[model samples]
Target: MNPVRATTSTTGALVRTGAIATVAASAATMAVAAVGHAAGISLDMSGAPIPVTGFGVLTAAFSLIGVVIAALLARFAERPRRTFVRTTVVLTVLSLVPDVIADAGAATRALLMLTHLVAAAIVIPAVARRLAA
Candidate 1:
């Protein structure tokens, strides 16, 4: 009756999404923080390497949060892969807003790019796997 009959089930897909989400989040966060630090963002917090780490961490956290939420939502959606592709593409497009506004400097711009990438990495695979299910 179902086009995607419980091949993988919502729980399985969610778990897969979680794994990818966490890894992508950690990597993107670290990569951006390193770049920001190199660019001299300043670390006002407890004598850290630089204050730029906050922005990087925030960006990654937001992305991870989105993935996590989406992972859960995907569980309920009829076609999670399509939903994920749609969601990621829309968000990625939206991520370009900063560039459009020209509000971010080089470091901010770079961080935004990383955020989009990390989100895509997690969403795409999850969706595909769910669709397979």
Candidate 2:
């Protein structure tokens, strides 16, 4: 196979893996958040009601963003696994900034951060591994 064809095939496989991982991570995050909500851990985002649907939507969206980043890195980065993992770690840290600054109570902020970490935990490694493969 030509170099371009090989690269495209690899990138495609990476993207498919990323998509599956994204969905699983999102579902897991939603389940945890639901349990927290039932236990009186409010997920109020600065007084705005964050319904379950909203949670799923946001999770899926952000997870897809990670997938896209992974795909790009797989296609172009000199060292795809290292570059993608490092970029995602930096982005994950930046993502917590809003939660820290939000006017919501401490528990809510903490829960939000946890969700972010959970999603990152599932996505970052899966994508990086695929990229490396």
Candidate 3:
């Protein structure tokens, strides 16, 4: 296989995988939020309760950002899979900072963090798999 053609193929696969992962992560996060809400965990922040759809919206947005990051790493990194996993894991952990300190109650904060983890768990590995080792 020509190197350029191989690279293009890999990039195309990465995009496809990332897009599917984003949708899955978004839906998974939304389901998590809905379950939490049903179980009486408040999705409230500040003074307002977060709608269930907000989870899907935010997850899709951020997961798409993660996809972009993976694409960039695939293009530039010598070990794109390792770098993407490391970078996204750190980012996923860092993403919980706001949830920990939000004005919401403990349960709500925990629920928020859980949703973040769920989305990251769904997206990071999927995108990483498509990256060069």
Candidate 4:
């Protein structure tokens, strides 16, 4: 195969993997949120309840952002897998800052953090698998 076509194929595969991962992570996060709610963990924050769908929506959005980061790293980084893993891990940890300081109760805050971790755990590995080592 020609170099340009091969590059395009790889990029396409990366996007496909990212899309699947995004859906999986979003669903998983939403499910976690629902389970937490059922277990009497309030989803309330700042005097408002966070809808379970919100979890999936936000997860999908952020997971797409991660996909973009992975694509960029694949194109420019010397070792795409290593850089993607390191960068995303830092980002995942940073994402919990808001949850940690939110006005919600401890259980709610912990649930939010758990959803973030769940999404990250699903998306990071799936996308990273498509990157060059």
Candidate 5:
């Protein structure tokens, strides 16, 4: 088997795994938030109520965007593993900015931050591992 082909195949598989992991993580976050809301854990975002459906959609969309970034880094970066991990980490931290600044109460902000971290945890390692392989 050609080394390049093997590498490509591994990268493809890794990206797919990362994407799937991201989706699962995002869904889990949404489910947890929904349950919290059902249990009277208010997530009222400055009077802009976030519906369960909206939460799911937004989470999934952003997770997919992370997948795209991983794929792009795998395809284009000189050092895919390092670059992807670093980029995602920075982006993940940046993502917390909204939660921090939102007018939502402490619990809501914390939960929102948790969701972002969860998604990043799932995605960053998956893609980085593939790049290393």
Candidate 6:
């Protein structure tokens, strides 16, 4: 690690902020989705949207558990923001691999999408904010 690189405390703070925001954001989005469903809006369950929600739950769940996955990923030498955003985009797009490979049904597709979205939401801003220039 570079001597002038982000310090341990700075990395820790970044991860913590990402994690906290992820949980709050995921919960808020989920709650809003629930309300939207209750109000009869289209929730788009016919694709990879459902599992993406699981992504949020999983992301927040991991963050809340203090695993600091982002920190670990950020440990690489690249600039934090660039790394974070690139990784997120890659992961979100990768999450749909199953849907692309298999003739998944509606439920499966939606689940995958949900997971993808949640993961994206968690990965993006969480790392971006900290990695910001």
Best by lDDT: 4
Clashing pairs in 5: none
Q: Write the per-residue lDDT of candidate 4 for residues 1-133, one digit (tens) a residue.
A: 6988888899899999999999999999999999999999999999999999999999999999999998899889999999999999999999999999999999999999999999999999999999999
The candidate that achieves the highest TM-score relative to the unseen native structure: 4
lDDT of 4 at 113: 99
Clashes of each: 4, 0, 0, 0, 0, 20
TM-score of 1: 0.57
Q: Which segments of model 4 are wrong by more than 4 Å?
A: none
- The window of 10 residues in a row where model 3 has the poorest summed lDDT is 6-15
lDDT of 4: 0.95
Off by over 4 Å in 2: none
Better of 2 and 3 by TM-score: 3
What lDDT does the true structure give each of the candidates?
0.58, 0.85, 0.92, 0.95, 0.79, 0.59
Which of the predicted structures, 2 or 3, would earn the higher lDDT when compared with the native?
3
lDDT of 3 by residue, 24-120 (tens): 9889998999999999998889989899999999999999898889889999999999999999999999999999999999999999999999999
Which tens-of-lDDT digit does each residue in 57-127 have in candidate 2? Answer: 78789989888888888777899899988999999999999989988889888988888899899888888
Candidate 2: worst 10 consecutive residues by lDDT?
48-57
lDDT against true structure, model 3:
0.92
Q: List runs of model 3 lying over 4 Å from the truth.
A: none
Per-model TM-score versus the true fold: 0.57, 0.93, 0.95, 0.98, 0.84, 0.58
**How far off is model 6, as Cα RMSD?**
5.7
**Better model by TM-score, 4 or 5?**
4
lDDT of 1 by residue, 34-103 (tens): 6655777532233333344454456556656655656655667776666766776777788767644545
lDDT (C-alpha) at residue 49 in model 6: 44
